[model samples]
Target: MVTVAVTAVAAALVMTGCSGGPSSPATDNVAGTPSSGASSTSKSTPTPTPAVVDVTPADGATGVKPTAPVVVKVSSGSLSEVSVKDAQGKAVEGKLANGTWTSKARLAPSTAYTVSVTAAGSDGTPATTTSRFTTLKPAVTATYGILYAGQTVGVGMPASIQFDSAVTTPELRAQVEKLVTVTTSPKTEGHWGWLDNRQLMWRPKDYWQPGTKVTVNAPLTGVQTGDGKWIANDDSASFTVGSSMISTVDIKNHVMTVTRGGQVLRTIPISAGRPGPETETRSGTKVIIRKEGTVIMDSSTIGIKKGEPGYYKIKTQSAMRVTWTGEYLHSAPWSVGSQGSSNVSHGCVNMAPENAAWMYANSKAGDVVKFTGSSRVFQPSEGIGVWQYSYANWVKQSALA
Candidate 1:
């Protein structure tokens, strides 16, 4: 009887545990019922967000030309910020819009640069990226060449430097000026005259001293000028002044005296125009640049009205060089009877053939040719004339001292 009773109670306990019914302790005490440990399920993990990537001007780039337009683009998210910086870490000026950024100016050559970018996703989570790049080495450049250096030529050969391109930067002008150093052999003072932006000329208050040496150097390579321009390469030139030749024309006395190294070579009587209208010759420093055995002298060519008192269509003889508009030191066969006696030619100092040839032989291109008279005011255009104004006045015309 006892075995049957024990078996029955054990069977009942097994049935209670197996059935989907509540346990006796959990059912009896609601607040303190034993909790199922597996009630909390595993939480779903959030998907990993994509990283932002910036493209363009890829990192470690070299031989990159300054002409390359800088541009930056982003992927995987909208761009929040983009910046370009030089090796010095200064932010390069640029613009950004529509997930794209660009720079207006080109980058400098052989320079290292860095770029940083930041982007954000739809969830407002932010991401950042960085890159570095370097430009290619600078190309071989060319510079201006001084054709005639340190040499005293005609005033026509203004100390001129022919540039490869029109200079556009103040820095370039400064650089070019620094390369030019002039010293007068006789210690005469001079200054550089910038005729135009591209053409720079140098001249002394007076003519360059005989035997003076001038040096010109144009070293403009790899120099940065504004607007992506630079000098081409390196060049140098030097020239020396020749013998001392000077001549004085006395329009009042109607004579021209030729000299060499302070020694009077000869004096020839001449004639100048009667003072009236523009025919009167002005007196100042001048230089003879041409000498012709004979030359056509058409009064009409020089604007002298036909039938005018001084107007005559004819060829003049023994014409020595005078660079002014219409003037010469020549033989006046028509006035030979008045040679050394009277002033009879039109604004020119007329002389005999022998005397004119002698002056031509002794004179050089840069030799001083001075004229003196009271008939006309010395103007700047009267031959290669410098006596119209004082040396101080000449210096004032130069853009640089």
Candidate 2:
């Protein structure tokens, strides 16, 4: 009995030894048995690596103007995600190109912006980075103004203002018009006429009151015109109108009377056309073309041959103003004795220099310069002075209403 007991104990010890300690499980049944949970747990599982991403326009950059384009780039695996935000953190609209993103429109000035991006690695791990930037401050400046002021009656004297820069906004027009103030003797009501985007004209529906005072104030110190340009600084000018100085020239009588406020200033002796080469001056209103201290009268320039019987040439002196083609109210010293007495000039209203000066001093741009006593009324042509047309007819010539 003692020997059998000992044998059983030895067998038990051997079985325990054959079971491969803790490392082996069901080793004897490896040919067909499934592995226990302990066996499967022995094999380790791998954890995926995280991905890294980078975005452009890094954090805290400033002095950025809206005119500049916003660009963003990503790194690491790829641009798996990207976004831009305003100061309020609202997502701004943008477009993605390749691994980069961009905004089509400019950003607002003096604003803060943020950019975020995410990139994933092959291991399915995502990394993100954010950047901040600020926009540039706004610029404030002023601009200059142009003035066209004169008082030639008959539509020739229009108050024109031309802006050096193009006005992109209509509001600018109103701002400019506010600077204009007209003080006419006969109180007139008128509005601005925009000739184009850059030019404006101010005129009454009719001619200005005979003796009106027109003033222009252009305070375009820092206004923005357009195309990144501002009005010029230190620009201003003014002009004045004299009393009502209206003149009437009768071609048949060959006389011109200067009047002021219904009072005749002078009755200058004059000579009118003999009517062969359309010497008749238009009978409508007229404006002075220009003033010259002296001018040389050449008949050839007016389609008159130098040696033609009707053509004559002479040097004129004290020529105050010439208002028509081949016509001048100049000092005819040679004919001074005959002036105011007989029609002896070649169609010019010959007058003393003093008389011409008086006319010049009293006349403003819009003052009526009327001519009568012509069989054929004055018709407007390109060569004729601007005043040769009726007020209604002159308005029709303007592109603007």
Highest TM-score scorer: 1
Best candidate according to lDDT: 1
Tens digit of per-residue lDDT, candidate 2, span 1-401: 00000011112222222333575554745887765442222333344433434334546778765545667654434557667778677666678888667776446555788777666654545566677888655453333354534433433354556665456666666655655554444566655555455665555666555445566555453344454444434344444445566778877676788877779988877665556445655556665544565788877877789778778778876564434466666776677666655556665667666766666655544456677766655544322333453456545444333
Off by over 4 Å in 1: 1-188, 194-201, 205-207, 216-238, 305-309
* Residue 323's lDDT in candidate 2: 48
Cα RMSD, each candidate: 18.2, 19.2
In angstroms, what RMSD does candidate 2 have relative to the true structure? 19.2
Off by over 4 Å in 2: 1-156, 160-187, 190-202, 210-237, 322-324, 336-344, 352-366, 381-395
**Cα deviation of 310 in candidate 1 (Å)?**
3.5
Clashes of each: 15, 26
